[model samples]
Target: MSSAQGGSGEREESRPKDVEAEPAEAAAETSAPVAQETSETPAAAPETPTEEPTPADEPGQAAVTEPPAAMEQAAAPEPAPASEDPAPPPRAQPPNPDGEAKPQRTFTPDFLTELFRNPLDPGYADAAARKAAGNGAVGVPKKILSGVSALTLVALGFLLVVAYQQTVADEPARTQARDTLIEQVQSRRENTTDLSARADQLRSEVARLREQQLGGAALAELQEAEAQTGLAPARGPGTRVTVGDGPSPIDPVTGERSTEGRVRDTDLQRATNALWAGGAEAVAINGQRLTATSTIRQAGEAILVDFRPVTSPYQIVAIGPDALQREFRDGVTGKFFRALNSQFGMSFDVARIGDVTVEAATEPNLRQASPSPQASVRPTSSPSEGGR
Candidate 1:
């Protein structure tokens, strides 16, 4: 009862009825109403008599028919296309002149762009519509879901209660222990400070009493011991010797600065030993005085003189006769240091000082004496042995 204008505007006459639809086109038509008769024909076939659709059972009713699928498809409408015959798509337009694929023209924007533009997903709306219509996709029941959620909440609450109880149980003991430790630390610190002050007072008092009580020979002997043992500060003519790290040159092979020239603990130990060999009397290095018990040793990268660290450039002060500097230069110390200077780029300087003061050594050498063998009596031992 309806008519469609031809795409080329030709009369729908003088052509065989090209009534067969493409399988794909038939699928498209199934979802919609049957296509109306086109005013234009498909091809310029010779005119043929038309076979009309069968008439309806009711009188004066218009005949209704569906177009047949292509030769590859069944004559009757199919529930689904068979496996053997697949129909080609119907083309409404001619192919491009250049034979290249046509660029798809879309009115809608990209998916991400649309997602950002509209935050709500279309599927959510469709699901909500299905729910409103009381035909939602089957899943877990609401009652079961709600019961499970309640059980989960109850479990979480039980865990929280247990955790809080455990914390409460431990909190008091931990707090008490921390407070006790703090109090003990504060008390010990105060006690130590008080003891230090008391010790200083006692030391001063003892010194004053010793000066008042000790007379001529005793006083002189004490003074001599103090000077010899480096207990008292020294002031006399001596020599000043300064030794420093050598200059480091880059190595050609490694392309890095060589560490060979750097002053090591062993180097300082050797240098100090040389000074002792050169007859250094009451020597001090970097203000740390040296006694007979004093030691020069290596600790990691440091040089320790009597357990005290000495840094470069090392300053060695020797308190001795006016000839001390000259003797040091004439000794092996001078020749060895000169070799160091020539080979390793080490710096060494010596000067004779008319007056130099050296600080007293901080530590003392403890010694004990025993009675001579001649003084021991044999009478008591002999009596016990004779009786046995």
Candidate 2:
């Protein structure tokens, strides 16, 4: 019996130790399942690492269990690769299908239109208000000023009427004075006409006396002198040159017909000079005789020969030998005219005439004179007469 009891006590002590060991094994098994779950689901595992702790484990045992779970979570794969592409850029609103963008209206015209609208116009409304207010800005109404002006004008008119009456009252005396002046002018004109007639008669008498006293050679010399001095008309075979303004062309820059295309004074002068150089004895332009002192110049737009205005188409008549035409063609005037024809479309014409007659030039008045020494001296009485 004693041997049996000792064996039973020893078996009971071994049983208690095995029971404690079984609880520890059971805790390890439960922890092994938790570690496996933490490795599989790492994202959730970090949040609750110390999941439900065993009641039998001490604080030190729980601390040790947490480190292994944290290590397992760290070893987990990185989060599923970020979604492949970012959300497509917010789609832009589709463009309007109707039309292009409308332009923004500017401010100036709109502002001005609003400011100058009928009721808002400053000129009308402000002027009316200023006038109606009678604020001394304008001092007096336009009607009162106009009435005063009318009254003043009426007074001036009355004064003018009085002056006119005085003038009318003196009209008879003025008429007598005017009659006297007219009589004096008529008498002077009649005297001048009589004197001119007497002078012509005296000239005719002198010519008759000269012809009777002088022989045929002297008469011929006088005639030649008169012709050379352009005192008598000339008739001969020569050329006629006509220069005229061309049909005007529109100016490119000014958009008007150019006046430069017209015949000028210089052009006529050049033609006259060319004719004279070609041995022209007598030259006449536009029916006016060209004397030694005649001038070809421009006065305003018209050409003046000896101060007399002549219009185009200018006809220059020359009395010379038939060779004048040939000489004129080879002269500077011919070249210049050709250039005008090509460049400005001027009109130049030349023709030979068999019977060309040029009128005589007007006689000139004497401008200066000096008395002879003999005429200036008065004769002294003879010495014999003085002695007597």
lDDT of each: 0.55, 0.59
Every model's TM-score: 0.50, 0.46
Q: After superposition, how far is residue 323 of candidate 1 from its true place, in Å?
A: 0.7
Instruction: Write candidate 2's Cα lDDT for 1-388 as tens digits.
Output: 3332222222112111223233333433343334344443323322222223222322222222233223231222111111322223232323423211111111122333332321222222222222333332356777897899999999999999999999998998999999999999999999999988887677669878988998799988986766656766788888999888887888799898778779999999999989988899889999888878788999888899888899989999999888898778767788889789778888888889999888876553334878856664455554445666
Give me candidate 2's TM-score against the actual structure.
0.46
Tens-digit lDDT string for candidate 1 (1-388): 0111110011111111132122333433342121122112211111110221122211111011111211101211211222323223333333433221211112222445433433433233223323433444448787887899999999999999999999999999999999999999999999988987886677659767887899789988887788767877778888898888887888899999876666676665665676667666678888989888888777876788888888888888888777778877777777877788888988888899888888778645558899766456766665556777
RMSD to truth, every model: 21.9, 40.7
Q: Which candidate is the best by lDDT?
A: 2
**Candidate 2 at residue 29, lDDT?**
36
Off by over 4 Å in 2: 1-164, 170-209, 248-257, 365-388
